[model samples]
Target: MSDPIYEQVRGNPKFAQLVKRRGRLALLLSAIVLVSYYAFMMVVAFAPQILAVPLTEGGSLTVGAPIGAAIIIISWLLTGVYSHFANGPFEQLNNGIVRETLK
Candidate 1:
């Protein structure tokens, strides 16, 4: 059986706004991650010597290590950013939609 509450929520303008905002945020974050990763890979492929440079005069660690770590850290931070908005604003909007639909 079709549910009226579901239909109501689906018909709401706020639901559309929520979907659009969430999708845009997700796409923006995904693009950032993809660009960073692909740029890193491109550099690694075309300019290996750049990453091969040592941090110190006689250090074993290469510049790529920190850059790789930063990419990972940035991805994690982006996830946190998405989670923050999803839980904060998105959740609030969702709850409001559900509450209004139920009423």
Candidate 2:
């Protein structure tokens, strides 16, 4: 037999809201990452010279290096944002839903 608690949680409006919000956030972040990565790849394909340029006059470093680094840093920051929301608001809402459903 299915647990009633699970059924209650499934029926809760807060649970639905949590799922929607969490999913939207995930999708939005994923889209941001995908677009950034793809755009970088497109540039690499069509405009390699731009990325190949030296960061400074006669410098050894290329423009692409810093751009690639920025992409990595942005991804990490996005992950942290998701973690913060998931741990804070999402967890709180989830706990509230469980508590309300149990009572």
Candidate 3:
């Protein structure tokens, strides 16, 4: 049997807005991750020397170490950013829309 509540929410403008906004954000984050990951891979494959260079004249750490760490950190930070926005305003909007739809 078809559900009226589902139908109502499906037809609601807020539902559409929520879907579009969340989809755009997801796509943006995914693109960023894919680009960064592939760029790193390309550099590793085509320019290993670049990542092998020393960070400083006397330092033991290779440039790749820090850059790799930064990539990991950035990924974590991006996830946190998405989580924050999703749990905050996005969740609130979702709840409001669902409540309105039920009413």
lDDT of 3 by residue, 6-81 (tens): 8888888988988998889989988888888889989999999999999889888999998888888888888998
Write the residue-wise lDDT of candidate 1 on 1-103 in tens digits.
8898778888999999999999999999999999999999999999999999999999999999999999999999999999999999999999999889878
**Cα RMSD, each candidate:** 1.2, 1.1, 1.1
**Counting only residues 3 or more apart in sequence or on different chains, how many pairs clash (N, Cα, C under 3 Å) in candidate 2?**
0
Ranking by lDDT: 1, 2, 3
Clashing pairs in 3: none
Per-residue accuracy of model 2 over 5-31 as CA lDDT, tens digit each: 899999999999999999999999999
User: For candidate 1, which ten residues in a row score worst on lDDT?
Assistant: 1-10
* Per-model tally of clashing residue pairs: 0, 0, 0
Show where candidate 3 strays beyond 4 Å: none
lDDT of 1 at 65: 99
